[model samples]
Structure formats: structure tokens, C-alpha cells
Target chain A: MNIKELHRQYKKRLAKEKRWIRFYQLLLLIGFFVLWETASSNRWIDPLIFSSPSRIFRLLMDMISDGTIFIHINYTLFETVLGFILGTLIGTILAAILWWFPTLSKILDPYLVVLNSMPKVALGPILIVALGPGMTSIITMGAIISVIISTIVIYTSFRNVDANYLKVLQTFNATKWQMFKEAILPASFPTIISTLKVNVGLSWVGVIVGEFLVSSQGLGYLIIYGFQVFNFNLVLMSLLIIAVFATLMYQLVEMLEKRLIKNE
Target chain B: MGFLIVENVSHTYFSKDAATEALQDISLTVEEGEFISFIGPSGCGKTTLLSIIAGLIRPTAGNVYIENQKVYGNKDLSIGYMLQQDYLFPWKTIEENITLGLRLLKQDVDRGIASKLLKDVGLPAVEKKYPRELSGGMRQRVALARTLAVDPKILLLDEPFSALDYQSKLKLEDLVFKMLKQYNKTAILVTHDIGEAIAMSDRIILFSPRPGRIHEIFEISEDIRRLTPFQARSHAGYSPLFQQIWKELERLEH
Candidate 1:
């Protein structure tokens, strides 16, 4: 075959492979729900704890009809997004500060290690006491969870940029600030985007745990309240909703990554 | 007095365990628009001397003067430096990279300048493309354009063509030589290649290693100097001069 015909065949094969992979993904998701429903209804698993997909879907319908699901989802989504933005922004700024002052980074190195190692969720109670048991405390919890790790990772990337790039700028008699702006920050973009992807998951964990502690409102509260009342369907419903939103947020970050790093 | 002067310059790099002298008592002078090359063995501190001359690094004891003024920490004098590798910012487009020095200096970035430099470097239509999109030689050409865009008073090229394949290296040497002559720009090249030094420079300074000092200087004959680098390489005097430098370099290495 000619090159054009061969290229056409290659594209066709790639499309077929993609279709099969997507088909399997869909099949797996459906098979999981079907098996869980069958097991619960057949009493192969304890229906009370296992809580079939149909039961969860019926519970979801009830919550949707009552319009109560949106409230919890909205609260969780807003807190997670704000917390994620604040965490990434604050961490990047902190990293820039550390980059600007090497002496400060050296001084804070041990403390950063300590703070990063300690369970940030464990600080929920203290945050609740200090910031009060409200959205403020919960958002702070989310922000705090990812900030230290982001600072450390981004700072490492900043430091690791090729020194030659700085040398080029220095030849032009560039100021320190210009070096950071033109070379260091832009060079560290790929790292920053990857850190954003990690922070998405981290912020969710923090917000959920904070809600569990606050015991006020959100998907985490729903899960906690469901466990107390023995409502397995409610817990399952909240879990499924969280999964969908988290994946959506991750996909959004992926989209942003593609846009920002178009040159590479 | 020459256009650029290095007077009794020496440098020592310090670490916790030891302080190593990298360059010692290096003094040289280049007349205006003179093309000079420093050829030497590795660790000869040719690059260190170039950095010192560019005021990127301070000499341990001595001074570099450009047009009767100290070069160290002097911002008014523009010095263009090109490295072994292209080192173009991957995120920046060719246009942005070329205008970077002007922007850094807070000068009004003239759009015409980028296009003009690109044309001069024979890379006219690649302004919007990133550095990664170009070939190695092409990227290096873009780097040259970027360096020249600021209209530096002196250019310090640290093994700029060493990374290229032979054909591209020869071609770039010709291009750089022609452009420097066309603009009447003063330039200093550091090279490990004796032939390249002879082909491109008016005067070649061969350096000795181990506390790095100048060993010898060779001046090109007037007949050989009139031609482009590629033509100069094919001239009768080229091989003899190359042989002499090669023998000097061999002796230094041993």
C-alpha cells in the first residue's frame, strides 16, 4: 500500500483500540453495579450493609426530589475548589519566597518536614476551635492539607531549573526578580500543573474529614450521619456523588494542563 | 589602549575542602572590532576568563576594562554571551526569546528588531515557534539572534559551535563570522578546535591548564583574515597555523 493508505489503516486501528478500551471501561462499571445489586438481593451479602445500587439510586432520587442533595454537593464543591485554589496559590507564593531567600528556606527546612509529616486532619479540632466550626474551619483544613507538600515540591522544581538559562539572562544584566520571572517560574510550570493535579485529591480528603469532624453539612456529614443511623444506601449515594465530582475536577485540571503547556 | 582590556586577572573557586585557582595572571587586549579566540585544553579556565571579562564572575585579583571603564557590575555596557548549548527558554517563542534582553532592560521592545535579527541569522519565519520545535543548529542560530538583538558592545562566545555536527558547525562559523564583520562587532570566541580558532579569529590566544594561564598568541596573516571563515579554512596558511596550534595543544595536554 501507498503511504497515505497505510496511514489511513493505522488511524483506523488506533480508533478501534480506543473504542475497545472504552467499551471495557463501560462494561466494568456496569458489571460492578450489577454484581453488587445481584449479591444484595440474593442475600449472598448482607443487604443491610451491602446496600445495592438500585437502593442507592432510589435514595438519590428521593434526595434529588427534595432538592437536599444539591445543597450538600454545592457546599462540598465550593469548599473543595476554594480550598484547592487557596492551597496551590499560597504554596506557590511560599515556594517563590523560599526561592528568593535561600537562608529562609534553610531555616524552615526542618519545620516544613515536621509539618508535612504530621496528619493535617488531626488539626481539624484545633482549626474548628480557632476558626470556629463552620465552612471557614473546613476550608482551612482543606487548604492546610496540601499547602506544605505543594511548597516543597514546587520549590524543588524551582531550584532544579537549568542554571544555563539563568546564565543567559545574567549576560543581559537581568535583575534577580527578572531571572525568577523569566526563567525559574516558567520553567517550573509543568511541575506546578502536576502539583495542581495532586492537590485536587488532597483538598477533597481534607474537606471530607473536616466535615466529619464538624458534623454539620456536606457529603462527609451525610456519610457520618448514615453510619450512625445505619443508612448504608445514603452512605453509598454520597460516595458515588463524590467519585463523579472528583473525576470531573481531575479532568478539568487535565484540560488546564493541556492549555498551559501547549509549547511542550 | 585597546577597546577591551583584561589586566592581571586571576580567579580562585572556593569550596569547604579546598580552594582551587582556575585562572591566573590572565591579561589580554582586543582592538575595536577585532575577532579574538581563546583555544586551550580542558580546565584551562578559558571560560572562567570569559565570565570574568563579561562581569558574570569577579576575578580573584585584577580587573577587566571595556572602553576605559570597569566591566564588573557595570550594567550600562551590554555584553552578549552564548554558551556551548543553545539554552533557549523552551516556553518562550523565538520572538519572545530574541526580545528578552530588551524587555529585561526595560527598553521598548521593537517588533522590527526580532524579525531583523531572525533574518540576519537566516531564520526569518520561525518567530512564533518555540525552541523545542527547531533543530539543534536552528536553535543555536536563534540563540545567536537573541544575543545580537540587544546590540551588545562585545560578544563572548564560550564554545558556541562545539555542540553542533561538523557541517552545521562549519556553516554556523561562516554565518557568525560574516555577521560579526557586517556589523563591525567585537567578539571573543573560546574553542577546543584549533582549526576553528584559526578560521574565525584575527588573533588566537592558546592557554595552559592548571591555574590556567596564557601560553601563546598567534595572529592571522592579512591575506587569510580578509576571507570568510569557510574560505579562510581552505586557504594555504590555514593548515600550517592549525598544525602549529594542534602541536601546542598536544604539548600542553601532555
Candidate 2:
């Protein structure tokens, strides 16, 4: 009936349209990869900057045979997963603790802003100096970097919860913990899930940076190594691996959100 | 003490600069099963009075008692309050929302009774449905069910049907009235609509705005509140009675 409502209706229908488009896109992707194999066989395009998809696929085979690909992938995933979990947990707990006390929230607010502004890579050197170069330094610093964003996002959403709902809870004489359990958590769930989606990207940034900084083995190190040797295939392969892992994590967060979040 | 008593109950809202009185020297009593309405113009503190009685607020000075028990500075689980908003938890199914009070109690309840209450509320099929999936009236029904599930001795209603369309409002008022009667609980309704008060209450407490105080009172017999608001609108003496009430409310506002 109204312009906004009409737009909402159109947008609601857009998902179904996109689903079909995505299926076609999948076909196009498979064709592009096949076409790469075909073009390289025919010697049509230079497989330098634009490495042949077939060659990349063969690299995948070689990496698997040598077991180096699994090692790097596992290391990257280990760092990313560890960082993601630790970041979310520490960020949420710290934000909640700080949010409870306005004075502390104010005091630490700028520090978090400063911490968030600091490039995660800078933390890499400090963490290595303190915790030493290994998975611990990488994961801890990465967690620290990504967790701050989640802390800010989830805290803003948690803080933005409706005053009226809080009033209702107050009328119930709900304990602070009860208020958090019943109203705060559920109300902030959508925002928290969205923050998780955002932090998934940040977590990957941390892991890749961590790997590039001091890791013995990881997708990030592999990328750096490929770049050093001027091996375009290895670089592309590592980038693709990171992309796949990040996409999987993003999808997992999305699925969890869809399952848990109410329409509200 | 009456089943509920408000003795010189007054409320003043304090801002940084000054204080504004919302209610002044208000007093009323409701028997155990009486249905009363506080009716007046907007900003007349009708809702404020009901909120006070519900223990949602404490008067600046004065006291309220429930069954001879001093209420201020005490948490009240003995009352059921339904506000203008349905206030149903959107993420929860109807059954979950309805049983919220019981869940908060952290006690074991008879499933048989809960189901029976759902049937009594005329919403047995709603248990599985989420709040957004229901019509506005149905959502309020669940709210009512939730309030009643606590089995409070009294119920406070704050213009709970103001958001509904006329037809739906009449239907819900009739349904709620019948359900309240069956429960045989005392009720205090806050409404700006005089006709609604007259149709649904045994007595009306009118208040003047700008420091709301009791201005007038009306006594209705058993006959009127039994009819639907629409049906009561067409009742014999409805027009002249509402005209007088409308004039009185307007006089208070200006």
C-alpha cells in the first residue's frame, strides 16, 4: 500500500529470484573451470597471472599427495577457529561485564576504541615477544583483534534493547541475571548473530596476518612463500583455500543465525 | 481493609528541575470481584492510578494495601497487569508466552490446567503458533491468558484494546469480560473512552487532568457490562449518557 511496504515486498521476493540465479551461477563457475582446462589444452590464453583452472586443480592434487596442503589448511583453520571462539567469548564476557558498570564502560570504552584501531598485525610483534612465535601468539592476538569488534557490536545491540521491555522486567522485579537471561540475551540475539557474521571476516584477517607474520606453516605463510618464489599457482591456491575456509565459517554462522533468531 | 484499597494515593513525576503531580489524593476501594474503571480525558492519571494499584508504582506520599497488606516497598506477585500493548514475547509460541508467569515462578504446574485454560481463553490451536503469526486480538488473548495463569487475586487493565479495530475491540472486550467474570476476580480498567467504561465496569472513577483528581463517579448495575460495546452503544440510554460523559471529559481537558 505504501512505498516502503512495496519495497519490502519486492525485497522479500528477491531471495527466491536470487536462489535461481545462484544455481545458474554455479553452472557458470563449473563451465569456467572446465573452459580453463580446455583453453590451456588449446594453448589459447597465458596461464601466468591468470593461472589455468586446470593447473590450479592439478596443484590441489599435488598438495593432497604431498600432505602439505592439509597441514597448512589445518593450521589456518586451527588458528581461525581458535581465534574466533576465544574472541567471541572474551569479547562477550568483557563487554557484558563492562556494560553492567557504566563507569567502567566509559573508562574502558576509549581503550577498546584504541585497541580496535590498532592494526591486528601490530599486535603480532608484541604477542610474539610476550607469548613467543607459535600457534599461541597467533591465535591470542588474532582473538584479541577480532573480539573487540564483536564486543562493540554486541554491546551496542545489547545496550540498544528497548526501554519498555526493561520496564516490564523491572515490574517483575527481575533480578539482573534474570533480566539478562530472559530479555537481554533473546532481544540481542539477532545483533549478536550479525556480529558473529562480521567477526568471521575479522577472524580470517587476524589468522592470515598471524600466519604471514611468524607462522612456520599456514595458508598465509604458503601465500608468502609462493610470492617469494614467484609461483603464481601456489599463491592462487592458498588464496582459494583461505576463501573456501572463510566462506564455510560465514555460512555456518549464517545457518546458526537462521536457526536461532526469531522473526522479530 | 477492602480487597484492594487506595488511601490518599497520589503520584508525582520528578524531573531534574521540578516535580509534576500526576495523581492527587486519589482514593477508591474495590470488593473482591468488582469490575471498576477509572475514566477521564487524556493525561488524567487513570493509567497512573491503575499502575499504582498494580504495584508498578508507589505514590509519592500515601499508601495502598491489598487485603490488609501494605504494598509499597514490596514486590507484588499477587496481581495481574495487562497493558495497552499485548507485550507478548514475539519469539515464543503462544503456549510459551502464556506460561511465562508460571515459568518465572519456577514451579511445577499442572499441564492439564494450562491446556484447559487455553481452551477457556478460546485459543487451543494457538499454542504452537508464534506471536507474530496471530492477529492483534489473538495476541491480546494470549497476554490475558498469561496474566491469568499467574492466578492473581486482582487484574489491572490499561486500555488493552485501544490498538484494535472497532469490531475486533468489541469482540475482545466481550470475550475478556466473560472470561473475567468466570474467573470472578477484581479488576480496575483505565480508559479514556467513557462508553467503554460504562459498558464494562460496575463503577467509573473520573479524574481531571493537570494533577489528576477524582472528579465524579458512576454506578452501573449488572445489565450494561454484560453486552458487547457495540451492542451497548445501541442500548436505550446510551446516547444521552455518553453525551454527558463526553461533555464532562471535554470540560476537564480545556
Candidate 3:
């Protein structure tokens, strides 16, 4: 079978998708702009309290010219990147440890569930107490949230490896390292990449929520400031910006996963 | 004592729930360079016997002797086992999967050895291919090459070709026959296929069910072993051989 044929099918599907993308984007732009103008013209909402699309666009232009938005955006992006790396690293290591020691994995299983189920907002005060706010608090919270997801995914993936593969290795009198290197790791790679994809959205949630708890900068801080000052357009602007960046990260992860799996 | 001896073995899987005996008081001997086939009804401890020899499971009451040395507790790299399913690593190329055993053994796997094996198995072009890229017959051939790559003294096969189509099955049977003949390797093939047992094996061990013990052993003539799988079916003497084997099978079926 020509694998290129299979990939051609994917490309064809993508072609159909882009047409829909263009269609929806055009509709969304027209709809949102028309709604903003109509609401403004009719004085349905206060202009200063909830700025229209034109006003928000002007604010965006000014922010871009002065690089104020860029600076804050970069800082938030840097924190997320750091947290993403740290959380993924720690989570992978912890998962390996848990898998290595089954008794420990068993003992920690219930505690991990509890931690996962706990209200993340309740941890805000504790995070501020420990990290004293700023990038530190945001990064810590992001790591805590994302690391759990990574651990659970990696652990499950490692456990779910093909028994036949293991049997082959065992028959060969393979060392533990060899078994892990050949069978366990390769089998879990796709899963780990998918886990990373899942964590992208989760890390964004972490960073934004942590920022709401405490931060003088970032899109999250801007959202809170807009709400307090009653600037609805700026709130929507921040939300959109965060959404775009998170989506970009998720796409990048997916692209990387495809490449990695294909190369293997 | 034979070249490889299995002396009265047993196993009882004890659980908090209950204990189940898997094998009981089994003893057997196989000579060097012998081609043996194990034929039995399902759940007859046939696989349990193979697993014991492969060192995957320990026989509770018996000892396994290979080359007159006790084989239990020796995790030393010695034997090679081929399972019922091809168990080819999908992620790995055919050549890589074939070389897996040799690489693990820290043996300098000669390219010639791999190439020759591939050629011998009619899969020279398939070296760079992955398991998914190959057909069921082709995959099993690669698996056989992988088992052979170790240059093993004893080959333990568990229903190695039971999954193949009729044409592939017959062809693979021919290939296996050629390999066993060429290398003079002792092979223990576990198959329910009476035709396969008769066509390929020098000796057939008929097994009874549950606490599986040897029912009987039939030794084929050297003249019959010389015949190709297709020709063997047409041999004048083949009918009586089939009749004798069928009689054992019919008895076991009851």
C-alpha cells in the first residue's frame, strides 16, 4: 500500500476544512462587527463601559504601537513556556518513579485523585502564600495542574503496552533498561505527545487562573482590570488573545506529535 | 537421558480465591537436532510445557535439562521462542525485528547472516519493510528469521503457522522444512494441524487434555522426511501414515 495515498487523503480533508474555516471566519467577523456597531449606535450599552469593536481596534493599535500589549503578552507567554517544560519534566519523572515502584504508585493513587478533584481556586491563597505572587505563583500553579495530567497519562500509557512485546523481550532475556527502551518508551510516545496536547489547554487555564489570583501583568490581569474598571471590550480582547495563543500552542504540539510519530 | 530432558513437572496457581493446577507430573526427552511436534486438544498444558522450556514459567515439580545441564533458574540467554501470533514489532522494520534477538545477545550480527536468512526465506526485498507492510505469511517468515537469527540450539514454536491462509500455510511449511533441514536445529513445533505435524516433524507427541501427559509418540521414516509437503501428500505410504495419525487424533477428539 502506498502510504502517500493515505496522506493524500488527509491533505484532501484539510482542503475541505480550510473552505469551512474561511466561511466561518468571514461570518464571525461580519456578525461580531455588526453586533458591536448596532449596539453602539442604538446606545444599547454605555460606550465607555463597553467599548465597541472600532474602539477596541483603536486600543489594540495603540497598544501595539507602544508595544505595551506585546511586553505583557511576552511575559505571560514566557511563564507558560517555563511552566509547561517544568511540569512535563517533573510529571514524566514522577510517572517513571511511580511505575518503577508499584507499591508507591498504589499508595499515591488515591492522593493523586484527591489532588486532582480539589478546587484549584482554593489553592490560590496557598500559592500566593508560598510563591508571593508574580511569575512564580503563575508558574507553580501551572506546573501543579499540568503535572498531574501528564503523570496520569504517562502512567496509563506505560501500563497499557502490548503484552506480546513484553513477552518477546522477556524471552530474549532482556535487561530492564532494554525492555523500557525498546518496548515501553516507543509504545508510550504517541500517548505522551497527546498528553502534552491536552496539557497545553490545561496549562493556559493554570496560568490565567493563577494570574487572576495575583499578577500585575498578563492577559489574565488585563481581564480582571477591565472587569473592575467596567471595560467589556478589553475583557473580550484579552480572552481572544489568550484563546489564540493557547490554540497556537496546541496546534504546535499536534504538528510535533505527527512529525515524531511519522519519523519513528 | 536425551539431549534435552523434562523430568516430572507440575504447577498450581494459588490465589486468594482458589488454587488451579495447570500441569502435573510431566516428563519428556528430546534428542539433539530432533524435529518434534506437540498435538493436543485445547487447554492440554501444551503451551504450559513450552513456556517452562522457554523459562517464562517455572515447573513446580520437574526439572528441564538442556545439553545435560539444569535449565531452571538460568536466565542466561540460551533459548529462542516463537509464539502463535507473529508478534512482530509494528514500529520496527523487518530487519530490525529480525536482528532484535542477536542485538540483545551482544553478538556482532553479520549483515551476511541477516541478508542470507532473508534470501533463504524469500524476503530479501522486505528487509527495510515494517511488520504492517508485510502479509501474514511474510510476517511469520520474518518471525521465523528472527528466531533463527540467534542461531539457537533449540527452537520452541507455538502454533507458528495456524493463522495463515491455506496457500501461505503450505508455502511456510515448505520454508520451515527447508530451514530445519539446512540448519539441523532441534525444533519443537506445537500445532493442532495433523497434516502439518505429519508433513514437517520427525516425531509427533500426542498430548491428552487437562493435566496434559504424553499419549504417544510416532516416529516418521527418513524417506518421508525427504519428501516436499506437496509430494508427501501424494506418497503411496502417506495414506497409512495419515491414517495412523488420524486414529490418534480421533481418539483425542472423543
Candidate 4:
């Protein structure tokens, strides 16, 4: 066949394959909800614990009509974004400090390993008591959770940047600061963006656990409150909301990645 | 006095396991505008010697002098060092990469200078494009532009064209040779190619491997040195020098 005709057939096959995959994804989602609703209605499963999707949707509608869910979502969203930003910013700054002072990095090597291995969530209670059981403590929890890992990962990327690039800069009589700014930081951008993707999920875990402990506000608080009241529908709805927002945050990081590293 | 001098320079690399002597008692001198090449077998520390001369590393012994001033620990010296690969900053635009040295030096970053250097390297009107957008030969040309942008007094080229295809290598050789002569800049090239060494350099220093020491030096005849690299390869004196250097290199490898 002609080249144009063959190309058209190739594109048509690609479109068909994409449609089938998307159709299957939607089918799986709908099939899961249908199965859950049916099992609950038929008393085949413990509806009180599992909670049907319809029941959760009804609870969502009630929360929306009362205009109470917005506050929780807004509070959670603010804390999450602030935590993610602070975590990445502080982590990157710490990494830069480590890069600048190789001696210091070597000295802190054992300490960093210990801190990274230790559970950051275990420190949540102490943070709540120290900073008070407010948004400040929860935000600190979110920021603190991802900070150590981010520092380690980002610092490794900074170190792994091709030494030849620094050699080129050295020929120019570049200062250490210039070397960091021109080659080291720009070269590590891809790693930093990937870490951002990871931090989105980590910050969510931190904030939610903080809310579970504090039990005052946010989606995590809603889930804890639902559990206390035995309203599994509210818990499921809060979980679904968190899932959606986390994916959205991840997508936003991906967008920033595209904007930042255009050359790749 | 020579414009550049390497006097009794030796370097030994110490690690946890062992110490490797990379260069031993290496010394050389070059005039202001001369082109020199170091051709040798692998692991002969030609790159080590080049890095030493560039003042990026302090030799274990001896010193390098430029215009009678010490090289090591002198931050005022300007040297252009190129590697096998282009090594352009991938995140930066072509213009930004080329003008990087000037920006770092706190000099006036003139767009006209970047465009002019790009034009000189035969890559005009690509200021906004990233390094990844260019082909291999084009990226090397951009690298050359970046190196020459700072207008160093001496250029140390560590196999800058070795990564390119033969055709691109030939073209860049001619361009670089012509540009260096036109600017009257001193240059030191380290290469494994005997013919490249003969065609591009006025003097070829052959090095022996394992504790790299200068074994022999061949001075190209005045006639062949007058031609461009491509033409120099076709010149009558080129083959004899290439053959002689090839035999010497083969002997050194054993």
C-alpha cells in the first residue's frame, strides 16, 4: 500500500487501542461500584463496615448541602500545599548546603541515615505537643515527613551530576557558587521534580496522620470522626476525596516539570 | 621565556587501595601561538596532564607557569578546556550555554558576542534552541563556540572531536585549526589519532603509557603546517609523519 495509506491505518489502530484501554479502565471503576452496591443491598457483605458507594455519595450530598465539607477540604488543601512547598524548599536548601560543604556532609552522613530510617510519623505526637494541636503542627508533620528523604535523594542527584560539566565551568574560573548555580542545580532539576512527585504522596500521609491524632479539622479529622460515630460512608468519602486531590497535586508537579526542564 | 611552561610536573593519585602514578616528571614549553598535540596509548595520563596545565588540579610535584606567573592557585587565568563530548548544559539555551563563561566572569553578556561566535562556528540563529535540539556535530560546534566565547589565551582540547563521525570530525578539525590560527591562540590537543595529531598540530608529543612520560616529539614541517587540517592530510609530508608516529605509538603500546 501507499505510505500515506499505511500511516493512516497505523494511526487508526493506535486510536482503537487507546479507546479499548480507556474503556476497560472505566468499566473496572463502574464494575467495582456496582459490585459493592449489590453486595451491600443483598447483605452478602457487612455494609456497616465496607459502606456502599451509593451510601457514601448520599453522605457527600448531605455534607455539600450543609456547606460543612468545604471547610475540611480547604483546610486540608492549604496544609498539604504549604507542607509540600516547605518540604521541597527546605530539603533542596539542605541538599545545597551539603553539596557546598563536603566535609559537613561526610560528618552528617551517619546522622542522616539514622534520621531517614527512623519513622517520621512516630514524631507526630511530639510535634503536636510542641507546636500545639493546630494547623501549624499538622503542616510541620507533613513537611517533616518528606524532608529527610528529599534531602537524601536530591543530594545524591547533586553529587551524581557529570563532573565534566564542572570541569568545563572550572575552565571559566567560576567560583564555587557559580559552579553550583550553573551546573549542579540545573543538572539536578529532573531528580528534584521526581522527588516532588514522591513528596506529594508523602505529605498526604503525614497530614492525614496528624489529623488522625489531632481529630479537630481537615479530611483526616473527618475520617477519624466518621470512625468514632461508626459512619463508614463518611470515611470512604473522605478517602476518595484525598485520592482525587493527591492525583491532582501529582499532575501539577508533572506540569511544572514540563515547564522547568524543556530541553529534555 | 616560553609563553607557557610545565616544569617537572608529576601527579600521583592516592586512594584507599593503592597509589597510581599518572604522570611522572612531565615538562614542556610552548610559544604564544603554537599548536601542540599529545598522542599516546590509553591510560597514559594525557588528560591528567591537560587538567594539570589547565590549573584545575594541582600536580603532586613541580609547577606550571603562564607568562612567568604560577598556574596553580591563580584564579585570574583564563583557560578554555574542551572534552570528548560537547558537555553543553542541556537545560540551557544555545545562547545561554555559549555565554556562560562571560556570565560567570561577571563580564558584560553581550548578545552580539554570542551571535558573532555562533556565526564564526557556522551556527547562526540558534540562540533560543536547547542543546538537545541540535545534532551531535552541531552540538560540538556549539561547544567550540562556548569555549571560544571567553577568548582564553590558551585552549586545552581533550579529544573534542573524537565523539563525532569522521565527516564531522574532519570538518571541525579544519574549522578549529583555521579559527585558532586566525586568532593566534596557543592550543594543546590530546588525541589517540596519529593522523589527527599530524594534520592539526605543529608539534606532536608521543607519550608512553603507565606512569605517563613523554617518549618522543615530532615537529611537523613548515609546508604541511601551513595548510588546513583537511588539506594537510593530503599533503606529501603528512603520510610520512603519520607512519612514523603510528610506528612509535605501536611500539609504546607494547
Predictions in order: chain A TM-score? 0.98, 0.85, 0.86, 0.98
Chain B TM-score of candidate number 3:
0.93
Segments in model 1 whose C-alpha atoms lie over 4 Å from true places: none
TM-score of chain A of 3: 0.86
Q: Give the per-residue lDDT of model 4 (tens digit) for B1-254.
A: 99999999999999999999999999999999999999899999999999999999999999999999888878788889889999999988899999998888777888598789889998868999998889999999999999998888899999999999999999999999999999999999999888898899999998898899999989999999999999999998888778888888888878
- Per-residue lDDT of model 3, residues A138-215, tens digit only: 998777778887888899888899888888888778877898889988888888888788778777878888888788
Query: Per-residue lDDT of A52-163 in model 1, one digit per residue for the tens?
Result: 9999999999999999999999999999999999999999999999999999999999999999999999999999999988999999988999999999999999999999
Report the lDDT tens digits of candidate 3 across residue range B147-217.
88888778898988888899998998888888887888888999988888888888988888766778888
Off by over 4 Å in 2: A1-55, A164-173, A262-264, B16-18, B221-231
**DockQ (C-alpha) of model 1?**
0.88
TM-score of 1: 0.98
TM-score comparison, 2 vs 3, better candidate = 3
Q: Is the docking of candidate 1 incorrect, acceptable, medium or high quality?
A: high
lDDT of 1 by residue, B141-220 (tens): 99999899888999999999999999999999999999999999999999988888888999999999988999999999
Best candidate according to DockQ: 4
| Tens-place lDDT digits, model 2, residues B59-121 | 797888889887655655567888788887777777777777776656466676556777877
**lDDT for each of the candidates?**
0.94, 0.81, 0.83, 0.93
Report how far off residue A132 is in candidate 4 (Å). Answer: 1.3
Steric collisions counted per model: 0, 0, 0, 0
Candidate 3 stretches with Cα past 4 Å from truth are A1-21, A44-50, B111-113
DockQ of each: 0.88, 0.27, 0.52, 0.91
Better of 1 and 4 by TM-score: 1
User: In candidate 1, which residue pairs clash?
Assistant: none
